[model samples]
Target: MSNLAPSLTAARQLADEYPNHKVTLLLLTDFQLFDADINRVLTDIATFPGDVHAVVLGGTQVDGLMDERVQITKATYTDPPGTVARAIFASLVNHRPGARPI
Candidate 1:
């Protein structure tokens, strides 16, 4: 089963409890600022049993960290929400076992 939680702590707990299933933590926000702690969050997600995908919904910043495993697509101005949702769906569908879908 897939688990979608808001907080990282909760997500971690879920991951620990369901070590055999996939746990995805979706963060829906505009990419305005890049947080330094994002690295830690990514690290935690990587340790999960299933694939971890982050669907960022926002405009790409110039200084955003470029991770080959993380896929970052530009959300269209006309329908940003829909674009984000589609991107997340695509990520989930394309995600492979023991691999990170970026």
Candidate 2:
């Protein structure tokens, strides 16, 4: 919706923070549109030094991503949830390819 402007502005700030640095944006939101708004985020992120990964937790996606430099992943829920440690381990184990462990 029209609320995307603020999000885009925040994304720009996040992207411009470290010129030589790489960033992984994890968005834990209600849903994903895979629309122009998200495309804008991908576009801004594409200007970074290398490939950028955007993970959306607890979201629904209708379309596949089109950007080569930006990868989008969406995760949903099941069986309630787990402990923080378990979640962290799972996330690390299922971590995105082409990225190193933190």
Candidate 3:
């Protein structure tokens, strides 16, 4: 989806439906689609019970996007498949335990 808020909202709603399980949201993006609408969703996501990890493709890291609540990794589309996978894996491994990467 082009809009980040709606996608994240839907994910949050889906997680709400299954209250017994912890949800993990793996958001892969190029850091190019966000607008003002994402701010509110970010606020909500801060309190979300599940884990949120953003795998930023193309190495285009957005300023102010990294916060204590969300895990983020920077990888390039030009990188080899295994390199990207290792970067993602390392990021998740360093994240808090019990989170299932999506």
Better of 2 and 3 by lDDT: 3
Best by TM-score: 3
Q: What's the lDDT for all of these models?
A: 0.53, 0.49, 0.69
Q: Considering only N, C-alpha and C atoms within 3 Å, which residue pairs clash in candidate 2?
A: none
**lDDT of each residue in 1-102, candidate 1, tens digit only:** 112223556767777897666555544445443545665655554554444455544455623453444445656476635677676766665535565533
User: Candidate 1's error at 69, in angstroms?
Assistant: 2.5
lDDT, residue 6, model 2 = 58
**Order by TM-score, highest first:** 3, 1, 2
- Positional deviation of residue 16's Cα in model 2 after best superposition, in angstroms: 2.2
TM-score against native, each model:
0.53, 0.46, 0.69
* lDDT computed for candidate 2: 0.49
- Pick by lDDT: 1 or 3, better one: 3
**Candidate 1 deviation (Cα RMSD):** 6.8
TM-score pick, better of 1 and 3 = 3
lDDT tens per residue, model 3, 1-102: 345777777888899999987677777777676556666766765667678777777777565865577877777857667765765665555545775544
